[model samples]
Target: MLRVKNPVLPGFHADPSILRVGNEYYIANSTFEWYPGVEIHRSRDMVTWEKVASPLSEKRLLDMDGALASCGIWAPCLSWSDGLFYLIYTNVRSWNAGAWKDTPNYLTTASSIEGPWSDPVYLNSSGFDPSLFHDDDGRKWLVNMEWDWRKTGSHQFSGILLQEYSTEQKALVGPIQKIYPGSEIGMVEGPHLYKKNGWYYIFAAEGGTSYEHAMSVGRSRCLTGPYEFHPHNPLLSSYGHPEIRLQKSGHASWCDTPDGRSYLAFLCGRPLPGTLDCVLGRETSIVELEWRDDWPYLKPAPGEELFPSGAVRNWPADSFEPPVVLDEYRKKGEFPPATKSIEYRFDGSAIHPDFKNLRTERDPEVYSLTSRPGFLSLRGGQSPVSHWGQSLLARRQTDFSFSAETKLEFAPTSFQHLAGLCWRYDETNQYLCALTFDENLGRVLKVLTFVDRQFMHYDPVPVPGDGPVWLGLTVQVDSGRFRYSPDGKTWRILRPVLSAAVLSDEFGGMGFTGAFTGMFCIDTLDYTARAYFESFKYTVL
Candidate 1:
């Protein structure tokens, strides 16, 4: 029996758009602010898959500092035609002239899978979750969220709109028609284009992308249509009550098995409070699909769960297996050390926001800490005074017991050049301890925290230090205690005063960022100021 294992994918992968070329399927998902944008994974037999490459990894493809982590790359769609793969995604840089700021929608293409792909053809279209679909007549169309009433004159969110795209000009070429007003059926954003059984399907998500979200389908005969909503509208259903991983559904991409059976890879939260999901962020999940009486049905095995709980599977077990990498930063006597997760920076390492580690493809050249031969070097600011340059190493803080480490050589002629470790939820809420060596002031250590965008805790009691000192962070979630360590062993209690609660959906739940984890870093520094790291490591002890 060729059984497609249920709950096929796991982890913080979301808004999946899958395309099958021959027996191989290629999938791309939204990669928000976490750089090397738009994670791409490939699969066979519609079950097991592995991440191969990201098309938006370079500076030309994305700009991270331009958008916050949760809002960068949202609901991307992929399609393979001729010998290239066409990708369409959204980046809302700013709306209402920068009031509702984020990335704008974009589109690009690649010939080979792993990329040195071309730059994105920026679109002036006002929307998000961009997807591309080709019609039977060899014409192509683009679908995205268009702020109809909201951008036009309302205070509420908007609906999904469709337009024709020109690959040659890398731009939208026609009048956008509002085919689906989510207000009519609870749909909000993340719309995908699909064709099936001689009819066109606009499979999209509705609601505010939170608890009320769900997948809906609308059909029409022509590209510019008189579309009809599905009678079985809210097709795939899950946790809308009691707040579970099933809360926000929809933003799906269709896939088919070798035997012609169909399935969908879409966004679903984890089990939550367990090994499952909680608002932190929307992850990806795959469900076996069946077209019974010309409608779609989603059924999973008895013990099936969504992502995070969905264990990684190596599909087509005979051909290939996904490689597992153990992050032992200190194992091989690695250089520039490993990044310090959460720690009290002492000596040499100060805070430099220039190194934008969270940056997407837009300015990777500005700041980079790589693992080629093992040493991490923070370059001078891309310019003399560049605050937007971010060059830091970070991990999604998902697990409980862990320690982050870093080796610092603070050669700061001025306090402006710095390196440190942090636990950043947003610009408003973060805890940072840094090491600084000013030319005239010598060396000193400082701890800073922010809550509700207001500064509350500041431990600027200066201490002198020389040589390389290790910075570590130990967090005990059960008791709500976060401690910092100079050496990985002894700990000092530094309290973070809150302007608002850090835990809860209201304060932006730190649930499941795909690359999200409590990480060790060299600090978010600039491309101009130089710093060197001798070692970096993280361990779950």
Candidate 2:
């Protein structure tokens, strides 16, 4: 009975939020507009997971400048008591035209969860995945998911709410209470609250994260509720079961181990074989939860021999082995040794400190390891359609027959300047295979492509850029090819191959996002143009 690798925190890790503490386990997700905002992970025996720290780093607990690509951090909620370490998020400021308007939700604290975390306590915009419940007698509650704007009716997702939180008036006190309304199965949003035995649970996230999405539960012995719904309610869902390749499973969180065993760290998706697309977005998986008469169940068993058996087979227990290919930064100052380093999540603010020297976080000496000493400088901002400062540095294409290489030293005069290789699936769908300097093809090499977010195509290729250049991207699932190499063993396929299902979540923006093959440098006219990288391979064929 082993076998557990279902996106155990891979790629664009979505709205998770699992925690344990004693023997160690912790999870936190949803970093919409990227940045240094929420994205934590650590695991002891629940199948190897890495990445820790980053309680919205700072910038006043996250500020994704002009946040747009899926908007800022949402669904955070990580907790621990006595020893302290609590977090509550949602900073989605306007989700485009039809309004989701300035959703502001905050709350932070940390004694150690690998954080210096402490500033940010505002909480309340009346909606969006917020959770915090620690009651035995000490009381404290927050639970959310009530965002109704009333345009015509059909209960605009107006359900699930509860308040009363005041650790001595750190705020959130009184009148909000609505309680259960979800499971009618629409887009119910990610809400989490637990308290077994005497019961008070309410794990949510209903259909609408794409491929119909799901994961529901409800109960209440009065934490302010009349609740009771879970007569076989999607304790976990793969939607219509699409032959099970781990399609869009629901947003979940639950942990228990030290021997009692009861794990579940949800949010799944690994599509691209019979099409549901999902290019590695919304990951983090671990399941094994059985309670019985009190209701919990999700232990069908059998299924684990993973090398991407579509995802979730579970590994990392025989001492913790992580490293799936190359990341050769030469252990410079160490830290990214967990799954073979790359995790540079940044869309804007809160990444300063010589960019954490590497392991995650960038933008200081632009991104250097001793001024090109070992190479990797990346400096350029804005113009990935601007979700603010897109110097971009990615990781998480898991494996569709992978093959990603990088070796650059960019030198361009200005075609709005550039820097290569990308695969994005947000800020206006993406594809960019740049290396520009084209005043009519002087040192060209383009690809562009955007699809559904407009833009269409570009496709140039003159070459002879006078220096470093060997960008790549391979993929073999929904087809994505883009390559180049003046010398690195000869390669040059650029013609029209991209359609990695458009970066699937069904097809770009709003399917909840997934798809992020790294490296970017856009400089819509210099934000102090900079770009330098070397040896960043990724292999898994």
Weakest 10 consecutive residues of candidate 1 by summed lDDT: 313-322
- TM-score, structure 2 vs. true: 0.36
TM-score quality measure for candidate 1 = 0.74
- Give all candidates' CA lDDT scores: 0.56, 0.71
lDDT of 1: 0.56
Of the candidates shown, which would achieve the greatest lDDT relative to the real structure?
2
**How does each model score on TM-score?**
0.74, 0.36
Question: lDDT tens digits, residues 1-541, model 2?
Answer: 2244456666567878888888778888887766677778776655556676766755767777766667677778898887898888988877655634567888888898777888898978877888898887888889887777764344357787889889888999878888887877876877777877899888888877766777788888988778788777767777766776667778787867766667777777777777767777777776777677887866545442322445432221111112221233224322232234242323333332212111124456665555555566777777777655567776656566677788777888878888888877776677888987877767787888878768865657888748888888888877878889988789988878887878876674465657767777777885777787765677766
How displaced is residue 54 in candidate 2, in Å? 12
Error of 2 at 167 (Å): 6.4
